[model samples]
Target chain A: MNNYALSISFIDNKLLLKFSGELSLYSITTLQKQLNTQNILKIKDIQIDLEEVCFIDTATAIFINNLLIKYEKLDIKVSVNLNSKDIKDTLELVKNQKLHSDKLPSPDKESFLYSVGKYIYIYYISLLSFLNFLGNLFTTKIYYLKSIKNIRFKEIAFEINESGVKALPIISLTSFLIGLVVAYQSSYQLKIYGANIFLVDMLGISILRELAPLITAIVIAGRSGSAFTAQIGAMKITEELDAMRTMGFDPYIFLVMPRILALMLVMPILIFVADMMGVLGGMLVASLDLQITPTLFIDRFNEVVAPKHFFIGILKGPFFAFLIATIGIYRGLMVKNDTQSIGFNTTKSVVESIFAVIICDAIFSIVFTNLGI
Target chain B: MDKVIEVKDVKTVFGTRVVHDGLNLCVNRGEIYGLLGPSGCGKTTLLREIVMLQEFHGGSIKILGDELNGISHSKAQKLRREWGVLFQAGALFSSLTIAQNIALPLVEYSDLSQKMINEIVEFKINLVGLKSADANLYPSQISGGMKKKSGLARALAMDPKLLFLDEPTSGLDPISARDFDSLILKLRDLLGLTIVMVSHDLQSIYDTLDRIAIIDNKKIAFEGTLDEVASAKSEFIQTFFSDLK
Candidate 1:
């Protein structure tokens, strides 16, 4: 199955090329090597033998067909000796395929302009659908004011537990480690000049105003965002979403709204917890490595970091939550009716949400900097 | 004279409901057999049980003279090679093209060359009255009738001795349903296959089935030739056949 070996036999001016084993992609290297050793010009005539070939995939069939065509071009009277009708029919089919399919979008005709246009059109369609989804979501939320019971509070509570409560362990762990690394690296230079107290200033502002919320958003995007897409994508595949719609239930309210609302409500709380853990990690590093006491670090932290800095960080939570939840829910609901689409959409949900969160963070930084927060 | 399928005292339960109990049926070789029942009457469950896709709670079911409930895995696989099933909605693999879907059985079970596989693929597709060009299209690209036809072609890939059809004429239009029934009759005549199909289409049942079995209240209410079923003296049979009016 792995190797397609070929041997050439010369008998009385007429050369016989014997094909042994499978002539497939895995064995293409050896097949090409064996096929090249024969001098078709000097032999005057050749017989292509297939008596020993055990099997051939599509790639091997195309290879053998092309080799036969090359021999035919050399004016060397070459005859095919396929012992089985099966092989002969396969060669015919592959030959037809090459002739018919080759005429489609040949590189000679369409390349640069065609690809650029195709991608632009695809992106335009996706962008339009995304805007449309946002419009529908806004309308649905507005209607929630008249009928509050339609919001599915139980499902929202469940999602809060899943996306918010369940993610605490990993989020806190990563944030703690990130805090320790930043503190250690910064204190490495700070301790040289006995500026250990400034480590408190640097770690306090960075962990609260930047690292904690950003890191928490990313972890939740990976964990809960992908989970939301996969869960809804599976429901879409098995026709559960359709069944719900038929039974007088809105998927946006019952499925998407709960997930979005849960993430929005719990994101600030999770980020707050992560901020505490991260500061604790930095404080632990300061006390052990730089000889800064627990009381001194806290006293320094309180003097430099204002309440507005912490508020600015948590303020980005609902925005980040909206971006992640919307993208994930949109990708899931819009997935095509195939299992491959589930994986494809899930990956997209995670990647796009992460990218959007970073951009949102940068914009928040610029706005907050200008406002002097 | 040859019995292809025998079901005796078979029991099927779904939660609190007993779908089938002590249901007995015998199908002969090379005959078109139809299973008729109302909605939620366990016709599909019985088909699944016979095909060994689902297990029964009790009793014996024999297919091709082998006890389906007691057969070993290897033996079941060997038996499976001799029969083909066309599920409801075709259940054609969505990813693969029609030709590849039909060629799957031969490619896995036989050592035939690619040329032979292609030939068999084209032949079965033609046997089911599909155009040669239809072979390259995926399941989603085709219409519902085409999907059912391609499903039929896939079922007949290995020249199975028995063919099972689950709601073969359900989703098709009236004209397409009639054509499909004719195609089934043609294939059965050509291949000499014993066909057991579950259908609610009266036209299809009357047109294709040589014999009919009616299941009611967890048992076979009647089992006989189509003509015998039409004339059977029973309350269920009277109401069931009266629907033909």
Candidate 2:
């Protein structure tokens, strides 16, 4: 189907190129290469004969137009002879496509300074928008306090099941393994100093004060935070949020509140579970590595590790939950009207929430140290 | 005229809910053929089956001399390049600009140079009546009419011999719908394409379709020109085309 019969002849400083038999994109390349070898630069005129050609696609038509435009620029006279109405229509579509005039150049690369300024501008705007989102969230909650019975308890239960309960097994396994590693590593230094009995105090304080809360928050940020962004982003893309607004339902109250409330309520319980599991893992390691029996480990843990350490760690739970949920939903609401935006926002939510969790943890650490807790 | 598509005794069943039973139709070369049916009559399903997007339970459908049922993978891929299907939503890739979307098939299937590919993309954009300035815009930035035209341009990118359109004018305004109708007729005349469209837009059917097959009660009740369908005794034809007289 691509066999274009080509016959080129040069006479009296004029080039005559005849083409027929189904010229299309597949044949245009070969035709252009063949025409390039001919010394048409010295010619005064060129004539493209398509009288016998029955069909021509848009690509071939554009190729022919490009040839004509090139010759016109070279001050050489050009004429295109065509027969079929189909070919005539194709040529008419591409008749005005000049090479340099119609062709779009690749976009210029942005300068480094320009990109830096652009990112700063974007972050500043996002910061303001986030403050605005926080204000709206508080006002919505305050307004809904009068009709607290109208809140969706069923949706909150569902969120708790999905984000909190479903996360139990993984969090338990991770924190348990982390506690075992920390206790085992500390056993070596204790044994060297002949202070192996102190393993209980170290494991209890570290797991209760740092590892359990921090690790639990990170895992939830990875799991449920990303889910919130993807769920809300998809809803935004499908216009479900708009549909809810049109139905006189606020998406913030209907969609965002249940998730936030459920996470805030369940965060402390999950953290408490993580703390127990991490201590159990450390106790197992202490018994195996240092010959500290469970009873002895429990006695020393109770004597030295005060309840304030656990309470302090649990105190950070709701704050971390608020950060993760708010950042996730904010990124989700920022999603544009395309599928790609969902993925972009989901990634952003995971990263930003994890970062916020660590920063919040650090601030808590600093405040407790100054207060001598 | 040579037959470009032939669907013989095709049957489609979704878990015993029979959609099409013993459906038969033939589309000739260089004509705009329409599949007209009420909602849930499986016109889109039939179009999908013909394009190999969906499989039929029984019977054979052939296009461009290749049988669709149980076709080889390599042969199916080859046949796929022989036609272009414009989905209902224009289905332009959200990640790419309009020009890149139109140039995708050519870039994937052909060895054309970048310069030639760009020129061909421009030609197609102009062919579908889109402005050259709109080439760099994403699909979300364009209006409904522009999106449909961009989709038509992408469908025509490979210069296929056959074109399948699913409700091309369903979401367009009246002026845009008529413009799309004339554009279809013009493209058919210019490219000699054998088009198979599933549409219920009566105005589009009257304006562009050379022949139509109406499906009712799981079978083709009428298959002929508009004038021929006017006299058919089918209830759907009577009710749907009654105002045409």
Tens digits of per-residue lDDT, candidate 2, A137-242, equal 9988887675867577977999999999999999999999999999889998899998999999998999999889999999999999999999888777754454
Please give the lDDT score at residue B209 for candidate 2.
Answer: 95
List pairs with backbone clashes in candidate 2. Answer: none
- In order, what lDDT does every prediction score? 0.86, 0.87
lDDT of 1 at B241: 76
Question: In candidate 2, how many Å is residue A17 off?
Answer: 1.5
Model 1 residue A139 lDDT score: 81
User: DockQ scores for all the models shown?
Assistant: 0.02, 0.02
Q: Per-residue lDDT of A118-225 in model 1, one digit per residue for the tens?
A: 899999999999999999899878876558766778889999999999999999999999999999999999988999899988888898889988999999999989
Best by TM-score: 2
lDDT of model 1 at residue A96? Answer: 90
Candidate 1, pairs of clashing residues: none
